[model samples]
Target chain A: MFEYPALFAVAAVVREGSFERAAHVLNITPSAVSQRIRLLEERIGAVLIVRGQPCTPTEEGRKICRHVERVAMLEQELRAVMPSLGGEEALESRITLPIATNADSLATWFLDAAMGAAKRQGFLLDLSVEDQDHTATGLRRGEVLAAVTTLEKPIPGCDSTPLGSLRYRATASPEFLERYFADGVNARTLAQAPGIVFGKKDTLQYQWVRRAVGHDVAFPTHWLPSTHGYVEVSLGGMGWGMNPALLVGSLLEKGALVELIPGLCVDVPLFWQARRLSSALLDELSGAVVKAARASLLWTGAGR
Target chain B: MFEYPALFAVAAVVREGSFERAAHVLNITPSAVSQRIRLLEERIGAVLIVRGQPCTPTEEGRKICRHVERVAMLEQELRAVMPSLGGEEALESRITLPIATNADSLATWFLDAAMGAAKRQGFLLDLSVEDQDHTATGLRRGEVLAAVTTLEKPIPGCDSTPLGSLRYRATASPEFLERYFADGVNARTLAQAPGIVFGKKDTLQYQWVRRAVGHDVAFPTHWLPSTHGYVEVSLGGMGWGMNPALLVGSLLEKGALVELIPGLCVDVPLFWQARRLSSALLDELSGAVVKAARASLLWTGAGR
Candidate 1:
């Protein structure tokens, strides 16, 4: 059994970390907040908060709060769609698509296909981004209608369409490359070179080294987990490591960083996959993706 | 965007179909039930019941109710595991195995594997079943820790352990076979035979008939969606069709069902697959499964 305050109220409290501040932020009386939390706990039979100083969640409270967060998120997305739902004529045919993608894509060019599709046909968008590697998790959970995955196989009940390759080059600032690989970048020399990595768990650099050397090689690698920070570290000449071409374009153009091995890039073919729900929304989204892939990476065998 | 009553409340209403009935069931006043429904609607922003002779769901209401049902199911499962969670001398690791199987296997033998593993180590079960063809969907979604699948190919980011072949024989009551195939049981003759099917969406019979003959053949089939009922219909001499050997052992012994095609049974190889999470729980579960498979089926391939 679990309960929490209205999601917005709970979220406000969590964000502010105090009932007084959360009440102020939400423009509600502190007594009201206290009463709501008390009522919620009574109904769910789970104490949600530890009342002294900054509040913390009981185990059950954490679960209930998580539920609230999910509902809040769904509500935010639903709000974006509710406006269009006003007209009952289109209501029957309307279906919303929930998709999960990477943050980089959301900021970059991922929305182009969706935008084009929206221009022609109206649909609601529910997008959640974790990370490229973990996108499949979202697809598996039924949280998303479709996903962009590093995984090649389709989730059951869903079909996969290859988008295009995402190629990354082993690159570094000219200063770093010159300082470390002045002897012209051989396998032994490269193995000893200091490197910047995407994250502790990110094995892109290690994989690149193996592919280049045709064997397993361990190196003293520095972890800069942030996508933006990763390129910044490489650009600052901290070390040599693989970077997405799209992200390091400015550095490449400025001649600040040089590719250690030209055409020795890794191409991870992207895919758009979704469950085989007999949903017209899915079909429309699929059509939009196919069309966009033709204009973007779909033709370069990125979608093989 | 979508909200219904808390799972227990929804269960009560679904059980009784009215505020008064639900109030009586829960030993609460009808006013309390009305208040709960009103609050639930405001929180979920979905109209769960139409103000009519009987309650009905708006689309959003149906979705919320579905979520309530899912939450209810998970709660029941969690309660079952709660007792063991309190007993902790050694640090026991929990791993989730996601498997996709038909409901019949899920309700039957799958639980046996969990029971077998319970003595050796502590485990958490995350059971999800789609149709045999859709079990792989769980793998794609990562909802399951492992799966029993019909697909030959392994999903990405996971490995597959072949459990063995699951053979479906064309079986029916002796009386049924006698009536349907009075002339003889051959491809063409069976095409003209009446058949019992799992459901309208089930195409097993259709596939069997098409494979048997050089051309596509249609059989006059009646729908019996439940697995037990499908077998029952065939056993009652109402029709002839396929039935799993595991469920028909006693009937076969009693000569109630005779196999129409001897040694021509269709065998779909099953697999146990999981995400490549490096955890002790998965390792133990995998060990139990491999041991079970050794004792159970005809597996040749290796997977870890």
Candidate 2:
């Protein structure tokens, strides 16, 4: 593994797609890439690549490439920070930020923000989530150094910045709504009307009902149990549910579903709350989240 | 960190109270333990222990020992299961089991059960909380493989074994009881008195009050937001609260707190439910949990 020439040879083949292109990438003979890959597979006692026109990575090769890429990034980062550790007395500073986000955000925007922030500072993001509403509890426990929350009030030791409002529309299949709420949709009537919810304590529809018709009641629900699946079910007309505007915009345009009540949507105003301490990493991340929120949300700030 | 011959060297020293004893347990010379400690400190660049006749792990040492013990246990279990795997196959079986549990159990029996199970089999436990009533929702997401819950009914596609009742008592600090209920406390007066709750959805005290008073009404509260802290506040005369029998036994016997309603206890039958699967690892773990539960809980079946 420590043989740099051998490791680089295999990496070049993987990057360049084929033995011919690998030679170009490495500025070496094609035979070198082929020979190196052969030696690596023999040493490891496993096939690393599936020989084909385009050349595909085997499961083993994918693992190796992942490890290689991580090692490369870590080494580069270490080298970049090595100069700052010149003095023994220097304080080693690392800021930890915590964010509570849904699964979709975790698989996408969260990583983007982390990469964007890491360019300027050495930081760790401690992300944990129960749901959108309860994400602030991590901040209260001091488990996270910062958080993105739906709560307006700041957790005791943190400062709050309004990121933006997440707009949600009450949508359902026309067939399902017609079957369930045929007697004209009202709060008392919709109490028995079947609906789908993201999770327990997720009250987007309840809040919508309260605003449209003054009442506080547990909406009858089939807990679909995920951000993605809830939208899928609502599209499937299993029940009426709150769909994030971004996900449903195209669907609404296509007349796949009808909004239960137009302009009676709920705006969950998200905030970035960080510890009172002045932290450069937290500031950088806060900026990125605010930018993302602005681009994604309607920004009416009705809830705020 | 690598300089230490093995993990848990400091833990052995602390548990045994001497370097010689620790060395005997580890099958190494005392001088080797001392040298390892010195080298470990040098590597981490922090003082880990206070040198004394008896042993004590420093705050930093405790953290490292904890991390070392977890990793060591994981490594041992991994090797035990996949002894002859090539590097590729060795990484395949790492699975994380999510669980929902209340704070008291999390700090006590749950951690012990998880660690013991992990020692017997290689797996990771990720824990979250939803109080006693709502733990079932965790199962709906396929988030947790199993949970310790008050709900007796099994979630769909899961099996539940009754772990016995967790009895809770309505108690107050002697002073607070005297102050709030001066009419020599009876059922009716207790309901109207201010109460302390674990959270918004925690209905233990409310149910007890309803049984006592025959009506529902809001009582003032101070949310300490921790299970142990809530019990402590109740004992300190903050307000009337429901205390778990497992948690408050010592305090009751020591005369630090009083049970306001003797024989008027809420018996919540807890259950251990897991997905019905043919996996050997989950089978062993669920069985171990039942065994541990028998030893620690109020068992009510088979042996009864």
Against the reference, the lDDT scores of all candidates come to 0.59, 0.62
For model 2, residues B1-304, the per-residue Cα lDDT tens digits are 3543534667556434467756754657889888888787887788877776456668777666545444444554566678774332221234334556665555345556655674445454445566777788767655566788877777897899877766788888777777778786555465345566665446676578677666543343433334554565677565678887787888888877787767688867778888776556677778887777777767667542
Candidate 2 TM-score for chain A: 0.63
CA RMSD of all predictions? 32.7, 29.9
The regions of model 2 sitting more than 4 angstroms off are A1-304, B1-93, B186-188, B302-304
For model 2, how does the per-residue alpha-carbon lDDT over A95-188 read when each residue is reduced to its tens digit? 2233455543433234355435643454433344446777776567554556767776888878888877677888987776787777877855
Judge candidate 2 at residue B210 and give its lDDT. Answer: 70
Candidate 1 chain A minimal-lDDT segment of 10 residues: A87-96
DockQ of the two-chain complex in candidate 2: 0.01
